[model samples]
Target chain A: MAVIHTDDSGDPRLDDFRHLSTADRRPDRPGGKGLVIAEGTVVVSRLLASRYPVRALLGVERRFAELAGELAGTDVPQYVTSAETMADVVGFHLNRGILAVADRPAPLTVDDVVTGAGTIAVLEGVGDHENLGALFRNAAALGVGGVLLGPGCSDPLYRRSVRVSMGHVLRVPFGDLTDWPGGLDDLRARGFAVAAFTPRPGSVPLRELREHAPGPVALLFGAEGPGLTESALAAADHAVRIPMPAGVDSLNIATAAAVAFYELASGG
Target chain B: MAVIHTDDSGDPRLDDFRHLSTADRRPDRPGGKGLVIAEGTVVVSRLLASRYPVRALLGVERRFAELAGELAGTDVPQYVTSAETMADVVGFHLNRGILAVADRPAPLTVDDVVTGAGTIAVLEGVGDHENLGALFRNAAALGVGGVLLGPGCSDPLYRRSVRVSMGHVLRVPFGDLTDWPGGLDDLRARGFAVAAFTPRPGSVPLRELREHAPGPVALLFGAEGPGLTESALAAADHAVRIPMPAGVDSLNIATAAAVAFYELASGG
Candidate 1:
């Protein structure tokens, strides 16, 4: 375990954790894919166990003690500081007493993630980071094999998402679909049925999704309000909907996805 | 429909809409029996359509115009004011240009909500107001009969819960389950099967819940981390679990409830 006790917040070793509030870390942003940050002991432990390259960790001494088991065999700098100083450096106190930053790992190809997967989630227009995170967490819990990001989706590794996912964003395999509706063809080619979720008339109920598209299903969803576009809906093999009472608005995208994922998860 | 325009934030008529951040209206708080509040045009429309006695509404002129249809035949005062004044009175900018407050209706007994309910949700230790509200929203959408709040549950009428529920909390029937574990016996006596959701071993997979319990069901859930208590689990006719991947944590309480509700919802 590499532990360095330091009371100073300005030390350059904490550079990756600085100005995180201004996390314009998108690929198009100036810094180019800012460090993937995991907050608190549970998430930090997940990050340390992930494939991403951990640069350093910053936290109060007590949190470090909680994380000591995960720190074994690691050579990364573990900077220990007081809560106030750590808050000053991270720009927030709710970082939950521990923060670990990691360099983004090599992107997994859609095929790499889809191979041998029984159930996968494919998303489009899911721009909200927290929804994205919650979706991943549900996916992980429900045993969805992989996630394929479609158009208009935000980066799942954004700090808020990582925390919300409870670091499952680091554990669950995900990759960009890149081809839009055309890319859905690849899923079909791999013997997977593409089931798009929508509330349109003639759509089958969620429970019947398995009957419409048998094994190895790819559950497709879109952002809540706009929902699945015509192109995406047409590309799918089946249109599934969670039966809602008349007059109620459609379920939130993430919650809708959880229901679908729960239905298709093996042994459920 | 009654519409009254006023620019003054201090108008005595706008008292229900005043200092909402303080939320001094909670019955247990300094203020007695706080009015149930609904924000945003969608939730506001729901409020107008709900059974709760609408006392008054405060919003920008445009929002009132948008809600003209739902407001029809309601003699309750509809106070129109500038967005700036609305912000000041509400103590927040994100009221979505509208707010509605209704007197807390007479408390419904457990039988009132459970009557003719084919499926119901029973919550234990669900103290988070947002989770409580979201559960109601899911129940409303998924066609669950009603919510019976077990011990340790919070008042779903809290401001954040109302917004999170998109005001479905106002529409769905809910009541306190004063009997605790004994209440499970009541549900069973009413020809309803009580199924508790847990991650505990030996619990049947959720999909089997319909087969095991069949017809009417009362799904029981606990707080997120410490799930349903031992007594509650023993009280249930069957213990059901969502299938999860090895090493993954359980789903969020509300999301888990939604998945369970979706499973038991008829014709879904």
Candidate 2:
């Protein structure tokens, strides 16, 4: 690994780290190279270890020194600069003091995520980056094997999502399901029981989920408000609810996912 | 109820809602009124329904009309203004379209919150307002009866906490415990088993929490990074953990709380 020191904020090698806030938005669009970004030492280390190809790292001297162990194995460019130049290049004061950018690997398949997995999370309309990231973090913690994004989900590889997931987005395998509710059949084909989480009436209590699906389980979650679409719920093998007190609003999407993940993990 | 037409941004009558961003911080300090503020119609309605004394409301005409049923029983002054004027008063562009201010009632005691409760959440060093608020929301959703704040916890009534909690903070009962770990004894005397949540080794899995405490349970939590202080953990009757894959980070404080809340609620 090369430790390149420079005080110039306009260095071309730092272009990948420039204007990060705007650059992260719609990276798939023209003029937007949707590079996977990991912030801080923990996330940076995760990025270095993950399958995603690490492009380079930009940080202050102390942060680079702190990550020396992780850098031992990688040959990625390490740009060391003062905090002022780092902030100028990134278009914001990054308190994390360190960042690692990686190009997205070849997209994972639905099979790639769900293969050899007993428990997985399926999401719909969960467009909030923080919520999506948090779900990955919870899924990782609870031992959920993978995540399958159905529709209207945000990019889990987005910088905000990566940061919020504490870098678990890189660790948790995820893939887009282009067929919408139709794709749920594939999960069922793979012997996964699809359970849609909803507060709608007549849904089975989540506690009984293990009894309902003793084999592989796929817990489906919708956005906080305007929960799972009628089609999504109808398509699931079972509609489950956490059984909250009447008159209380539904839990946040990610928090709800965490609850369901814990229940399924514990029961299994 | 009197519907006052107010276009004046500087109206003294609307002072409670002025410069809300800064006004919400350290309300107990000099030049700070420490009023409980609720933003958005949902939270405003909750503030109206809570035990706190409703001071006044400021909102656009549309939001007022939407909350007509909730407004019917109250004689409090309702100041109607355009969105621009409302924004000017609050010093931000609040899309919530409604706001309510309330005076804190006499504080509830630990005994008061835990008296009839089968499940309650005790928090320590949870100084983040959003996390504090989300924990209350989860507590309400999972049927945890109340919340007790230990040292280093943020004020649940803070404006941001109130909003993030979706107004559940107003619904859930909470009180400060000035005695640190010593106050935990009061809960035990009241027939509550105080279980401190931590990822420390040798701690019992959270799934067996019900087995360990069949009766009432108080799930104690700490902040995100630094978990429960050693003294707090040692003082508790039990130390519980949600088993996770090795090398993964701990769950977010509130997300962990929700998972624990679900586990206990499911077993009960």
Candidate 3:
């Protein structure tokens, strides 16, 4: 690990860490489509383990030393400074103590993610970054082999999404299904029964769908307010619903996705 | 409804809604522990439908007109103001356009909530207001009959929790089990099989628990980091586990609870 000791906050080397909140404003910079940031030691460790190339790390000495074992084999420069200097450079009191910036790698093709995947979550119009992140976290925890993002989905690499997902967005394999409902057709061709989740009439309960389709399954989701579009629903082989109590709106999309993933993963 | 036109934000009658963020700072106010507040038409509608006495309403003329039906028979004061005035009174921009203040009714006892309930969620140390709110939302959507708060739980009536829960926290039946782990014995006496959720070995998977617990079950949860305490676990009739992928930490407490609620609700 290349440890660089510096007391200056305005040093040219610290340019990437300045006004961290606005770092993503210029995505056309050298570090791909914005630098993929991982906060704290845990997420930074995951970032280091991921395929994303770690460009640099900024942290207090203790934080860098805490990651010394993980940093030992890595070649990226680690910026060491006092907590005050670190705060001055980052424009906030980052209690996380450490941060890492990485360049976003070339995205995986939908085919790359779908290959040999048994259970996948196909999302449509999930533009809310937090919900997108939570869905990825749930997908990873519940054994969903991959995620296929459809139209109107936010970037999983967005800083807020990465933070909310606890870096699972970095771990889980995902790729944009650019073809909309047509991409869902491709998933079906790959031996997956595309099940669209909605509470509308004529839909089978999710529990029943678990038994009906025992092989590969692609569970489809949409944004919270307006669920799966007509085209997206029509493209699916089945419409499944989670049984919710009366007089309540549908669950948050991520929570709904978690329930579906649990049911499918449990093979119930 | 008793409608009043108020262009002045400094009106003494509007004190309850003044400096709303700091309104709860002094809990020992005229109303017990500050007034329960509901923001937005959707949440205000739930407040109207709730048993809590609606003391007064403040909103734009358009919002008041939208709720004309719900307020038809009620005699509560509806202070109509412009959006800007409403914001001035509330000390923040009111995007929800409407707000309702309710007197906190006497809390229901644990026995009151557990009576005739088939399933309940027992939470310990879930201090995060948003997580508590989301758990309540999940509890409402999934058929968890009620929530039992143990130690370190935050007030569900906190403004943030209410907003984040989509106001389902208002709809859900919840009560504090002040006896801590000893409350488990009381629940067992009420014929509930206490099943604490944790990832420790020797715990039955949540799906298998559904089959094993054919009778009323109390699903136990704790905060995400430090899960249920030993005393809580020891008191449970069984320890239940959600099947999670290896290498990942547990799912967010709310998401995990949602999966458990769904599993128990589906009776799989």
Candidate 4:
């Protein structure tokens, strides 16, 4: 490990660690070097273990000491600074106390992600970073084999999504499903039942959907309020709903997906 | 209906709606009404339908017209203000374009909440308003009869909780269990199996826990990080865990509760 103690918040060597709130948005930089940043010790450790190439780490001395085992053979520069200076450099008070930045790795193809998977989440219009991240976390926890991002979804590697997902975003395999409703046909061709989750009347309850599609399943979810679009719903082999009390709005998108994922993965 | 038009944002009649982000915290002031304020048409409608006595509403003319059916017989004041004026008074952009404030209703006793509850959620240290709200939403959706707050829990009626819950906080019954872990004994005495959810090893998986505690179960959850205190876990009749992928952290507290609540309430 190349350990470097730096006290100057504006040191040019730490340019990548500056103004993180805006750094992740630049599309014109090297390798889009607006790198994927993992905050907090837990997420930073996950980043170090992930396929993404770790560029460097900037955090407090205590945090660096905590990461000693993870950085045992790493030759990456580890900049140690005070919490206040780190906060000043990051343009926000990062209570997590540690941050690791990684270069974007090569994108995985859909086939690469689904080669040996039994269950996968296919999302549409799930633009919220936190929701997307939470979905990945649930997918990982419930044993969903992979994730396929349909149209209108945000990049899962976004920093907020990574942090909110507790870095499960790094563990779960996900790839773009560029064909929208048409791509769902590919899932069906691969012996997977495409069950779209919605609250529409006459839809089968999630319990029944699980009973019917008892094998490999691709659970399709849409944004919370608008729900799965008509084309997406019609494309699926079946429509599933979580039974809700009368007069209540549908559950949050991520929560609903978690329940569905749990049922499908757990055989309930 | 007391329909009044005010073009000026500074009108004294609008004092109740001023700087709404912080107004909800002032519970000690006269007409110091830490009134339950609902934003957006959906939540406002729920506020109108709840037991809380409606004080008044302020919104754009278009929004008022949309709520015409619900407001038809209301004798409460209705202040019509332009979007610009409403934003000025609220001290932020009011995209929902409507607001309603209601007087707090009589507090429900613990007995009032537990009287008919077969399946309930008992929260400890779940002080985050958004998590509390999401928990209520999940509870209402999954048919958890009520929520019982143990020590270190925040007020469910707080404004952020109300909003994040999509106003389900108004619908779901919740009251304090002031005695902490000891109150869990009361639940066991009432013939409700108190099942504490923890990620600790050797605990029964959630699915098995549901089957084992087949009736009148009280699902106990703790804050996200620390989980259930040893006292709370020791008091539980059964310590249950949601089976997660190896090496993954536990799910968010509210999401985990939703999954547990669904398992118990849905008879899976």
TM-score of decoy 3: 0.98
Worst 10 residues of 2 chain B by lDDT: B24-33
- Supply the TM-score of chain A against the true chain A for every candidate structure: 0.96, 0.96, 0.96, 0.96
Candidates 2 and 4, the one with greater TM-score: 2
In model 1 chain B, the worst 10-residue window by lDDT is B24-33
- Local accuracy of candidate 4 as per-residue lDDT tens digits, B37-156: 898899999888888898889999999998999999889999998999999999999899999988788778778778788898999899898999999989988888999999999888
* B148 Cα displacement, candidate 4 (Å): 1.0
- Kindly list the per-residue Cα lDDT of model 3 for residues A195-228, writing each as its tens digit: 9999997899998996778899999998999999
Superposed model 1: Cα runs more than 4 Å off: A24-31, A266-268, B24-31, B266-268
Candidate 4: segments with Cα more than 4 A from true spot: A30-33, B30-33
Question: What alpha-carbon RMSD in Å does predicted model 4 have with respect to the real structure?
Answer: 1.7
The TM-score values for the models, in the order shown, are 0.96, 0.97, 0.98, 0.97
Candidate 3: residue A117 lDDT (0-100): 86
lDDT of 2 at A161: 93
Better of 1 and 3 by TM-score: 3
On TM-score, the stronger of 1 and 4 is 4
Model 4 TM-score?
0.97
Model 4: CAPRI class: high
Q: For candidate 2, lDDT tens digit of each residue in A100-169? A: 9998788899989999998999999999998999888988898999999988988899888998999999
| lDDT at A94, model 4 | 89
